[model samples]
Target: MTLNRSIGILALICLPAAGIWFWQNPTVRQAPQLSFKTIKGERIDLADLKGKLVLVTFWATDCPGCIEEIPHLVELHRQYSNAGLTIIAVAMYYDPPNRVMAMAKAKQLPYAVALDPSGSLAQGFGNVQLTPTTFLIDRTGRIVLQNTGAFELQDIRQRLNQL
Candidate 1:
């Protein structure tokens, strides 16, 4: 094949790969304007947390994955809370407050735990319907990461460190 033709073919292959990488990875986006009232009666507004790195996780008490992730979240909170990291675990509207509170107590979660009784929190976050959906917002209020399933703790830690 001619050298020009070979170069053209390589460019075509690489362009799609780059596009896919961009599509699969996190992109800069503004976080939704919302306020959360924690089960502890602490009102946390996103605007108030503008200069902090926040992790807003949507979870349900009954979800096995969510249940399994509590410890990790707790540890993350312990490790980074003092370093400007704020973690909020939000219980789905379907989950009764009693159950949510019980799980929080049982898990000994140290972060703010909010109850989405009206589902407005979920709706504001792109109509999230999956348990363990997490949004990592930077200090500037831009969502740097959005994971809909189980997320790697190390990856989160690295991102947190980078921020």
Candidate 2:
């Protein structure tokens, strides 16, 4: 093959890999605003949380993955909260409001926990349909990471540390 043809072939191969990387881990340029009355009755607003690293986590009470991820999230909250991280844990629509309330209380979740009873919260977040889907919004209010399924805590921590 000519040198030019080899370069073209390499470009073609790399293009698809780049596209897949962008597709699977897309950045949410401007995260839709979210305001919710947390299970604890305090109102939290995404817009109001500017200048802080925000983790908008969507989880359901019944999801085993969600259950397993809480402790790690709590530790993240503990490690980073005072340093500028804020996590808003939202219970997914399928989980009953009462159950969400019960679980939040039972867990004694250190961070704010909100119930998506009307499904509005999840809908605002691109119609979030999966449990343990998390978005990491940068300090300037732009969402930089969208994670679906159980959080890869080590990966997440690395990203968090970079911010």
Best by lDDT: 1
Model 2, 152: alpha-carbon shift in Å? 0.8
- Give candidate 1 misplaced runs (Cα > 4 Å): 1-21
Provide the overall lDDT of each model, using Cα atoms, as 2-decimal numbers.
0.92, 0.89
lDDT of 1 by residue, 20-86 (tens): 8778765568999999989999999999999999999999988988887888899999999999999
Top candidate when judged by TM-score against the true structure = 1
Off by over 4 Å in 2: 1-24
lDDT of 2 by residue, 15-63 (tens): 9999998896687588888797888789988999989999989998888
Q: In model 2, where is the ten-residue run with the lowest total lDDT?
A: 24-33
RMSD of each: 2.8, 2.8
* lDDT comparing candidate 1 with the true structure: 0.92
